[model samples]
Target: MPARRQAPVTSHIWASGGRHLWPSGEASALQSHERGHLVYAASGVLAVHTERGTSIVPANRIAWTPARFAHHHRAHGDTDMRIVFLAPSLARLVPAHPTVFLATDLAREVLLALTGPRNSDYDQSARSRLSRVLVGELREAQEQPLQLPEPHDDRLQALAQLLYENPGDNTSLAEHGRHIGASARTLSRLFHDELGMTFYEWRTQLRIYHALVLLAEGRDATQTAFACGWANPSHFIAAFTAIIGTTPGRYRTN
Candidate 1:
């Protein structure tokens, strides 16, 4: 007899069915499916990028991505990933794009159960009901704006990595350019070409993202502002409001 081919492990419409841990610099290729996806980081952080934006999902948070949206996912450092896929009909409650949110303990437990062995002989009605409930809870969950807009050039990419590593660095564009071996004008042009924003605007966006992370960790705005390289708290607040669509305090409350 001819050798039989094993079925592929990956499926389009299915539960998590397993817990996956990823090491630093690990990444998944760009993929799109008819079923929506929920990606949770159990221990460290995961970064997700879609056509809409880039989400920085830390532990205790989950990123919901709707069906048919091309995207890529990766772990920043050593991280744990729990992924669940929902059928198209069940996923309609969520927007047709990516949204990040805080995952409740109950939801977390249910997500964990998804990775367990399946009961092949049992009726699947109970499983379907549970999955429906999870989908509902996930849809009504608060939407968080913890995303950073990505720049589209090598220079800005390098600068972004530096800013992310040290949010407190208060270097001017000229100074940063010197460190990155580029002239101020060249850097500015690169920022405009890649990010569609000025160098200062891009820096402000980075600071705001850092501020959100700090604030989520229970830091006050004033402290976060200084920590994110803003000379004045007021300036930080203004920039945060401009890009984030609300005051820092209001944004954090959700």
Candidate 2:
């Protein structure tokens, strides 16, 4: 039998650019930095959480986060990704909010070059030139919206954890309330009070997050639908489209 290879950590750069991959449902730490970040999954799905909301980045899409934004990043499934750090001054050229951009070929190439090892030896002047080019490209890039609201209350946070742990579980509000030691009516109020959305809306977003991971791994829509708790493929497609403005087929394709 062939040897099973361990997942690679690849590289981590101190302040410029780096590339790495994360498997399904994997999450990074809540981190804040002085520099801004651009996170892209060249082939997979990524979900990033900031104070404002969660942004879902599909393949060929990049997520931009401004400086000093405390955020966490996650990958749904076998996500091939790149993370670029920009100086605070340069980041002002792009939008301050979390936005997704369509990664064109030239933009992709520049990103790749920056993260590649060949440019490591470049002098300060060369690095500055590359940074300027990247900022220019990002300024001209088209944006896509894939924002999902974050849960703020402890009760809602607990509920979200339960759903994440068991995506296949079809627990109702009453069941969840019982488990969490709250009444169904109380839970309903908490949803609005904390998450700014209803329980069903939050559940739909969670399911879509899981579906994005499976789709990125090249799973068929039907399989992904069943895996993420949808009764049927059509239902999954509809929900996914309603939230992401694109189908799983298009979301996965670069």
Candidate 3:
């Protein structure tokens, strides 16, 4: 028999859920708020970028960035972004680094209840109980590798920023390194040490990450493939599926 999908465990955690909306391609300025928060994309996809890495938060995913972690957010498609500030105690339940969590059904319902229309039905005590449950559920939730770690070396940083800005560029790492005044060997070493991945692997991850944004903007697979520097649609599909756990065709941004 096939395995059944488990329903999301319901609970609540946010001391305050501040809701906001973003049109496709809109992004917040790089920032560091005083409080930590859980960011949820109820209708679209979002990318949360910090010093550590970029976390992709799709409709099925939630992103948690700790307090004072300088970060920015970008929307894919038209996003209904929801935020819940965490108290220091509740924030402890999430990791210090940015992370992506699968949004389960129960969690979604709980989030809507807490953050959506005011619930006169639930008094302060009920809401508090719900918050604890939500936090606990998120704490135990499995994390996804929807994050792309950032590089630190000057040359590598240049390369990463270049790729991030123009993911469709077909420049090879060795070629990029040469233009940046570094040898392929040195660049490879930097990538492995600083970013913990090979040049090719890192580029693949970056391309796929960009592909998510493009696809979420409702771009077709072939167009997205070209945009992400994948010459072949079949190759692009395989890479996106391997990294994102889904085929690009079904990876809805809208």
Candidate 2 colliding pairs = 24-76
lDDT of 1 by residue, 74-130 (tens): 665556677877766787777766888767767776665664345233256766766
Tens digit of per-residue lDDT, candidate 2, span 1-254: 01122343445574587877676556676788788888887666778888887888876667899888898877767776788888878898899887878776677777777777666776767777887887788788767666667676777778777887767567898999988888889989888876677888778877887777677677988998988888888988998887776787777664
> Which residue ranges in model 1 land beyond 4 Å of their true spot?
1-18, 116-123, 151-168, 172-254
| lDDT (Cα, 0-100) at 177 in candidate 1 | 89
Answer with 1 or 2, whichever has the higher lDDT: 2
TM-score of each: 0.60, 0.73, 0.84
For candidate 2, the lDDT comes to: 0.76
State each model's CA lDDT, in order: 0.70, 0.76, 0.77
Give per-residue CA lDDT, model 3, range 56-148, as digits (tens).
887777788888999888777777888877777778777887788877777767776767767456787877677677777787778876878
- How many residue pairs clash in model 3? 6
